[model samples]
Target chain A: MSGEGDIKLLGMVVSPFVVRVRMALHMKGVSYEYIEQDLFNKSEILLRSNPVNKKVPVLIHGGKPISESLVIVQYADEVWSGKGASILPADPHERAVARFWAAYVDDKLFPAYIGIMKAATEEARAEKAKEALVGLASLEEAFTQSSKGKPFFAGDSVGYLDLAVGCNLFWLEAIRKMFGVTFFDVGKTPLLAAWAERFAGTEMAREVVPDADSAVVFAKKLQARFGSNTSAK
Target chain B: MSGEGDIKLLGMVVSPFVVRVRMALHMKGVSYEYIEQDLFNKSEILLRSNPVNKKVPVLIHGGKPISESLVIVQYADEVWSGKGASILPADPHERAVARFWAAYVDDKLFPAYIGIMKAATEEARAEKAKEALVGLASLEEAFTQSSKGKPFFAGDSVGYLDLAVGCNLFWLEAIRKMFGVTFFDVGKTPLLAAWAERFAGTEMAREVVPDADSAVVFAKKLQARFGSNTSAK
Candidate 1:
């Protein structure tokens, strides 16, 4: 470790994963230098820090780089323990539930969203859209049950699962506007939708989450990039 | 939590994911009932416990079910803290590295292994085999750096990363035997190969990991199941 309080975040503005790291930092009231990375042409720092995946949202604390958004979030919680809101619960079972949902967001939800974005035909898009909705519905139920009638996934505070899911709200909204598709239905996923709104309204989210208009442009560009791949659907 | 020791693990015998949980339990000396579930025809209890994925290796403690292997491993480490060996590192950066590699095993290495197993043609198999080797080479480098001249990933003890990667040894050996192809070359991935041997020789691995002969039979059965899907490659 370097000197105390040395923290740097390497990420792109458009990436939901990066937003996750930012949200965690914001929740913890921890300050860090944010370095914007060009995804197309990655810098030496990005490549060196995360050699395995070479992906972004690398949290450099005390000169040590921690990659993977969730991993970074957990590291933040541990290192900055007793500072700001606790991302993961103190209870082991509750912590497991948070992790399970976070993994679900990456493993199931995001893939389903990507499937819709990559879909070539209307039929394929519809199928993928349905899958995405189903995933959102599951989150709705989780929020309904776990939130205890609170705004966030883990009660009143925006915890680990909240940051994991809520950080992607901009991207979700961008996709909705760009494709004229609704991934999270207000009626079906009322709790999750409400949580999204509550999360977006937070001071942390206001400061960290990317601008809506720019995110939509990025989403459109991403859709165009995926269009080149015929088998993406 | 339920009672003081009311823990039940729902798992399948041959699954590496299940073995991971078992390894954690064994290391922690946590006594729990292990119920083997049929993957082909999943039981109601299994489905009920893990409604989202409906997959195996669900840790049911105090009537609450925790799905996902890695999540369960972390939970075991936390709940049973100070009881036995700490699966995760105390240092934040070290813990992040462990989590990264464990995630890498799931997100990168396992997929490459699957690609090789699902390859239809010899040429495709050769390509996937090369990719799988590259992944193993990366793991070998990780072991060389992280092992610190010790046996396991987290030094003398078998920690999270060790259990994540090492538990799959039986499946790897089974695939090699069935296909008459080598995935982990002794010369190429000497560290990883040695680690595999070291892991398999351990008392825990010997007791938990399925026998090589039986694993081969299971591999053959899996191949047969995949045979119907011509586009598996």
Candidate 2:
């Protein structure tokens, strides 16, 4: 129920968690002030907003800050329920299913992604990619069940599970572009591979998700900052 | 809205997560069939119910399985909203806060608690306890803000954040009785220390939470099974 310009989102360009919130805003047509944070330098408001974890994707609504990516997305869905189709499924069972996959993305898949970036060599990167794909392969049935023969996890519309996985795909795309490490390998996770291409092509994803090339540069810088071992081999 | 027999909770008495679901059911005035699972030899129902995780604390409602403690608890709240006080707050911001703390319990607090159990040496156990207290100290502010001059996080009643942390307290109590490792140190986190006592004394907690003595025995057995190094000290 927030008026236009009343909402402000604190985020970084490279963070998939940030992208998830931006996508939710776009889907709901809730226009807000997007404050880009210099994560390396940190920001006063960002820290103040999310004092607990001190991370980004903090949505300032009516002067109250909501942090954590999943919580913020759910908050947006609840507060702006009338504005757009619900972000989470209306049915409790369906909602639980969406949440299960979302947690899976955060817990297993994201760490594997971080593993690729922080891995010292190409082989290590490949190993991380393989790990991520196994996680994705596990979700193939989830995608099938949630989609119900439709194109999205919400069945004809992008919903929580879609956004959860979709936001991370941009990073995967950038990794593939730079390191040739494929996450949505067509031969392995065919459905997710197709879904990735389709989701990335969407207007909301195109605008909200960080550009693959830009993310590639950022990824390189990120790896370099960690150590030269990342550049080794 | 589920009838007495319609809800089936798959769980173990020793699991804090399972205890959470039981607490929710009692609060909501809902009755369910409790199926105690053999964690070592998982039942066929448990396997079929939660194919993804195949873990305990799976709530089967109307033949649909909902896995994950947080998810199951939230699902229970949503599905039985009219029965009792809401598990999550009515306000979106409040809900977000509760979710954030629940997640914190899962991510940080639980792991630290586990560290104490898995630690081989008494010194290592103390170190883990110190780390856990640091995490608890951070939550003192959260309790103050969420409680807002009320006794509970949901203001005058047990709610999401309360159950999230409260369920874990029994384990801590067991650890305290056996290992003398205190999580809610009165000098360190006075509010949490007091809250833990108050929470455990409640009727819902007493009935649902596993007995501390039994948990202590379980803990000893668990540590012993891990290795003899656990007993060396």
Candidate 3:
């Protein structure tokens, strides 16, 4: 783990993925140059760094770039090991659990959230919202099981799982307002709701997380493009 | 990296996910009990161990279960570090690359392959097949760039990306035969084709990979259940 050279982050302001990387960097106390990219007209650096997905945030450390937010977060943890709060736990099983849940956020929860906002009809929206609640309930269970009375997913401090799921808070709140539906029920997912609030109230999160108003505006634009009877898939 | 207790794998025979765990175990030369589960009538162990996804390739080490194939593979590398051939590289950047490609296999290639085989009509199948080929081409580029003249994805040793992509070879071959279409074209993906052959021919792979005939049989059954226009998603 060497802090040898310049570090740069290629990202977009609106992306939750980008926010995840920023949170990880802040948690690790690593300094990096942040360069915002235009998603519609992606930069050469972004495209070259991540040709496969062509998305942000790409972390360029010492001239080499790493794509995928979770991947970059893991890289940051390894490269900056022992510098600050450890993102993943020491135990192998616990580390796997962290990865599994992180993957779950992307694989299951995000899609469900998008489905809720993008569904055409009220009935479809309700169904999608219900599905999203199911995913949230599972996440709530994860938080409860992983941290008994601790503040975050990986015990007392914010860790990998927190960064993974916390990025969605802005959009989740916006969807709650726009659709008049409560996905993270206090009765059902009390732990998750509390965790969400705690995560949002953190100084790092407050600084890094996109503004809720701006997030809502972005969500509305996304809905216009990806919502309704259109093939959002 | 202590080898302290009994290791048991709960898995289904036809699963590439299960195969991944098995390959990692064999690469590490770790002794483990392999217990095959019936997907139709899933065992209590499978359900109890991985209640979240309830899918197999759950590696139970010293009574704790680790779900998700790639996650388990990573756990194996960590727990059995310094034992045998390292699955992931030592460098953080290289490890991230390995992880990125492995995730790509799950996120992109597998889905495209499934889409090709499960499409409803010939036209849809052709389109899906083309999409799958596109993914394969990208994989080919990955292999070429990562390993210039080396044998495997990790340059000589059959590492993480090799196992991740190699597990799908059985099903890919089966699809080719069933559909009379060649997805892994020698002309288009010469390096990948050679790598696939090299990987398949490995002694470790011979022991872990499901036989082609058995894979085809399982694929047909899957096709019956998940194929055609009946909500493959």
Clashes of each: 1, 0, 0
| Tens-place lDDT digits, model 1, residues A75-168 | 9899889788889988898899989999999988888877766777778878887888888989887887678887788887888999989877
Q: Please compute DockQ, using alpha carbons, for every candidate against the native two-chain complex.
A: 0.88, 0.88, 0.86
lDDT (10s digit) by residue, model 3, range B89-206 = 8889888888888898898889888877677787888888888888889999889867767999999889999999999898888777778668767899988988998999999999
The candidate maximizing TM-score is 2
Model 2: colliding residue pairs: none
Point out the higher-scoring one by TM-score: 1 or 2: 2
Name the docking class for model 3: high
In model 1, which runs have C-alpha deviations exceeding 4 angstroms? Answer: A1-3, A223-233, B1-4, B225-233
CAPRI tier for the interface of model 1:
high
- State which docking tier applies to candidate 2: high
Lowest lDDT 10-mer window, candidate 3 chain A? A224-233
Q: What is the C-alpha lDDT profile of model 2 across A79-171, one tens digit per residue? A: 888897689999988999999889999999999987887877778888888888788888888988899988888888899999999998878
Where does the lowest 10-residue lDDT sum fall in candidate 1 chain B?
B224-233
Query: Per-residue lDDT tens digits of candidate 2, residues B1-233?
Result: 45644788999989999999899888888988889998778899999998878898999888888899999889888888888768888998899999998999899999988888788677888888887887898889899899997888788888999999998887887777766776777787787777888898889987888887778777777766766333422
Indicate the residue-level lDDT of A31 in model 2: 85
lDDT of each: 0.83, 0.85, 0.85
